[model samples]
Target: MNETLIRWLEEREIADVRSRNLELAKAFAMVVKSTDQVFDLGCGTMSNFRYLDPLLSMNQNWIGVDHDPGMLRRSEPLVPRTRVQLREMNLATGVRTLPQGPGCAFTASAFLDLVSKEWIDQFAAHCKDSPILIAMSTAGQPEWSPIHELDEPIRLRIKSHQNSDHGFGPSLGADAACYLVDQLRHYGCRVIVRETNWILDSRDGTLLSMMIDGIERRVQSVQDPVDAQVWADRRRLELLKAELRLTVRHLDLLSIP
Candidate 1:
């Protein structure tokens, strides 16, 4: 997928995208602070740590797990081992049990969207004992971006196109948070739904390029060669023009069942 485009799109939409996550993290942190342990799953590069770190700044055992070795390496240096621990785990093949003993909170960001439906159910079950689950940017559909009215078609089409991408997992686009909310509630979780609509500005050029590139690649998978080339060229010009803003619809769910 075109990470540039995704990043660009996300940059414009960052405000709405992660606003709830920050809030959720703060709330979850309160619970984490009271517990002996905290967990961050699929801790890709520990980028999610930025959200949870403030809560962990004091003395709490922080553990982050991911299948990606590189992300673990990057995270190890950024987070203190005394306060934080890192592990490798294939999120698709989830853990029947969490690494640290059950605690007040388990946090994940953007990771939930990449997992399959089966994984989510399993996750809900595994995390049942934990007091709170904070999932940020559970990608969903019926995007709630402020500009959803304007880019609904494009966003919808792009999401559809990207579903065919190599790594497109079974995430419920833009609505994972909402779906999880329902599931957690079904599982007896008292879920708190907080949604954010972020306006991404041009600072995220690489992000935009990535999204467009990912889309272009998917479209090219079935499109004519010449047509694909033309679209590619057109996208190039659009990026060159700059000042293009995007709205990212992000949904976050906090559950304490």
Candidate 2:
């Protein structure tokens, strides 16, 4: 993966902290214990590690897995007091190789939405008996303040793009969290879900700008260039004037057997 993407993942952690559901984290923490092994899927640079390490029991072992060696290498320095072992693996197919059963937990942050339904089914079966916390899967279209007519059209384009293959075949995209919840329940796991929306304002200019740029890229192929540029420019102007507010809805899931 590119260094820029890794840096974005690191920076995004700040926003995610504010968005993460505390009650759901506490509930998941109650089931974990010292010395339990946790596998963090798609753990880019271990931002999830920093967020989860303190919440989990002391001395818990973590296996941070990602396909990118650069990200795993980047995660090395971020390790605080927890014992972390980084692994390079393609989670789309390698999830079945993860350990299961007692004294283990499964977790992933902002990952479920990128994977296909088949991959999720395999994941649900693998973690059926273990406690799992999957957080920050996008729930729906973002809410933008000072809404514009182009907002709806751009949003629809983004949705269409999200359903395309994201390295795991057809992505569940915005529907991932709900599908995972249903799948977990079918396996007899008690599941809890909470909103973890990213509410960005003027102070979040850099992150918000990056988000807008991403949206522009996603909509470029399907949306008219003139309309897309107009929308992007308007958003930039709003950010510059400190009048922009964006609420990106996400869901956090905690499942216990």
Candidate 3:
């Protein structure tokens, strides 16, 4: 992940707290027992661990896996090193390489949208016996409180960008969660999905700004440069005036096999 993107995720934790489905999290926690081991894929800076550790009562061991060594190194200070182990692994190859055992749970946050349908199927196949929680995937719906004429066009462009290959094959983007649910169920797992949207306003200015930048960048890649810049300028003006509020729709999925 980009460093700026990682920082944006860190900043957006507050919004995630408000948007995440607590009931689902509690349900997942109930399924976990003491001394269980949880593996977090694309763990990045370990924000998923930060959000879940307190909710789970088990004296569980956590393995944070990421392809980026820098991310793993950066997460060291934030996580309890004794109970949390950070490993370097490339999820792009497949999830089969992840450590496996009984009483293990698999998790990832804000990650599935970047993977392909094939990758998710492989993930389900490998973890057929483990309970899984995948959170905060983009749902291809973005709403601006004070609507802009360019909003829909921009959104479409961003969605297109989302589906672009991210090393694993064509990304499933917004369709990832639903695909995972179906694939996991095919593998005989029970799955539940819930919405987890980020509601951003002036109070979340930093994250809001970062989101605009990201959207604009994605749009630029797919549209004429001049048109993209104009759209971005209009959005940035609203952002500068503190006149914009954004709702970024995402989905969270839980699977028990």
Candidate 4:
């Protein structure tokens, strides 16, 4: 969530660039159906604008919110200042600053994995009174990876790797993915969920590298030097291995109610 982790996301997710983009596109397509307008939460670097650009070009209104001013500043040039409105907000803190009324929906890609259930429940409550849709939530956890066949050590290691990320939000928000499905339905959204699988073997090193580097940086901030070193060495080995098949199972929450 820090700039340091953001840098890691940028660096290591190179290989997953296409796949991740595709997933976002699929989510956007399902949500808005027609791109009249959208509200993007945690609009980091506003990079998501370009990914969903096909929708943007329809002259749809875009309102992006993020806590990082640096990301908002970087995203300003992508659209006419009028068409795109970027604000500073933290959804976990609250979305009272989010624009009111309906016909527009909320969206987030790979974002559910970063906030707590308290945030999700509060966000759902915000939309309960309107025809607002919580367009997309891509949670890449509780997945079935091809590496299921690998020895237990690596698998356990990968699980341990995920341990830190659990604190990020909903342990990838898989349960929230389910909870949102129900909540959105109650909000009158015609809700459904789609599971997406992305395979990461040795051949796809970009995201692997990013995950490793990001974890390393996070570990460095702690006081447990010995524990950090051990984690660092294991992740380094995984990073070098070209054939690590990590399957990403992500959920697409559809809200049409």
Candidate 5:
């Protein structure tokens, strides 16, 4: 499949399985008035908006920021009832440029892991009074059912790769949500953290396969290509046999003033 198509499919799959913290969301909804401005960072194909729009006040004004024009374009049609202004701005260098105020809230999905500690600090400082509900940040390494020997090695390599610069200086990777919580609390904002793990089985074959392929792509350059291929092949076979299960831990964070 084309990489872009794969991303869209993966985003859809994630939306279906995402475990949002409803209590926190409700609180955030209460904090944000119908007239408040909402900012969705790294909005991608608007999965965050599709999930959050119904929870927020109707006719709320929104700004969806992303680095990719293609993603922004695709996101526009996803929420017909909502009023969203899409901007193709890279979050790395542009986060500080976003205006924050009393009647505003910030949101992002599957985005915190890609940013650096400095970036988070800057963002947290700027949006100190604004309610923030960031979702789906990787919490730790994934677990595979019927363990394989190569799992540990591949996981380590993938973790290392994840921490590498992804446009934002060194990425915080699995530590992002934790660090953000600390940062928000430092700024006197009440923070809530919740686990939203993705539990994939045979029923999620396509997502599982794509995840395996994604892992292989990340680890192959650092480890032996043959080993990466072998591991991926075995996982695919297990998927076909209905013996594969995967658990990827993630965190959902909410910050309230």
Candidate 6:
């Protein structure tokens, strides 16, 4: 993942309260019969563990995987050393190394959007017997409380950027949640999906600002750079004045074999 994206993930971990499907997560926890071994893919800073650990009733052993050694090191203090294990693995080429089987669960947060179809297929093949819970995959829609004229164009450009390769090949991006649901069902796994959109307002200014910057960067790469900058400026001003609110659509999925 890009360094900018890692920063954004840090901000998101703090601001992303709505994106966690607690009820579904609790349901997943209830089904665990033995030691809960959760393998969190792209586990930047172990934020997913921070969120789910409190909600789960059973004893958990988390194996957090990421290619970034810095991220692994940073997350070390967040989780108890006895309960958590960290692995430095690039998931794009390391799916074969993922742990699987009963008592194990696969999880990722705000991560599926960055992966390719082939990567997901390989992941599914490896974890065929494990339950999976994936959260916060983008759903390609941005709803602004006070609508702007440039919103649609900027959204289109961002969507285009999302579909571009992010090291795993052309990414499934916004369509990742639905695609995974279908793929898991084909494997005879029971799957459930829920909307987990991010609702941001004045109280979430920092995250809102980071979101605007990310959108502007993506938009600039594929569309008129000037327009993108101008739109970002206007949005930043609105954010500064506490006059902006945003609902970024996302999806969460739970699958059990």
The local distance difference test score of each candidate is 0.59, 0.87, 0.84, 0.56, 0.83, 0.83
Model 3, residue pairs in steric clash = none
> RMSD, model 2, all Cα superposed?
1.6
TM-score of 6: 0.93
Q: Estimate each model's TM-score.
A: 0.76, 0.95, 0.93, 0.71, 0.93, 0.93
lDDT at residue 103 of model 6 (Cα atoms): 72
RMSD in angstroms between candidate 6 and the native structure over all alpha carbons: 1.9
The reply for model 3, stretches above 4 Å from the true place, is 223-226
Lowest lDDT sum, 10 consecutive residues, model 2, at: 218-227
Top model by lDDT, which number? 2
The better candidate by lDDT, 3 or 5, is: 3
Query: Per-residue lDDT for 119-157 in model 3, tens only?
Result: 988888888688788989888668987887788777777
Per-residue lDDT of 1-257 in model 5, one digit per residue for the tens?
24655375555446444566777677778888898888999887777777778888776888989888877776767766348889889888898789886878999888899889999899989998898999888889989998999999888888887799999999999999999999999988989888888888998877788788888877867644436888999999999999999888889888988
Residues 1-257, candidate 1: write the lDDT tens digits. 34443444345344433455566667666666454577787776565665566665476776788776865775677787787889887766656666433654677766565655566677777776675555546354333222323244444455664343224355555545666677778888777866654444456566556655655565555533223445445555666776356555666677775
In terms of lDDT, the poorest run of 10 residues in model 3 is 223-232
Residue 123, candidate 2: C-alpha displacement in angstroms: 0.7
Decide which is better by TM-score, 3 or 4: 3
lDDT measured at residue 102 in model 1 versus the true structure, 0 to 100 = 60
Clash pairs, candidate 5, are: none
lDDT tens readout by residue for model 6, 174-252: 9888988888889999988988888899999988888888788777678554377788888999999999999888888
Residue-level lDDT for 141 in candidate 4: 41
Give me the runs in candidate 1 sitting further than 4 Å from their true place.
1-20, 99-104, 138-157, 161-169, 222-229
**Candidate 2 Cα errors over 4 Å, as ranges:** 80-82, 222-226
- Pitting candidate 2 against candidate 5, the one with the higher lDDT is 2
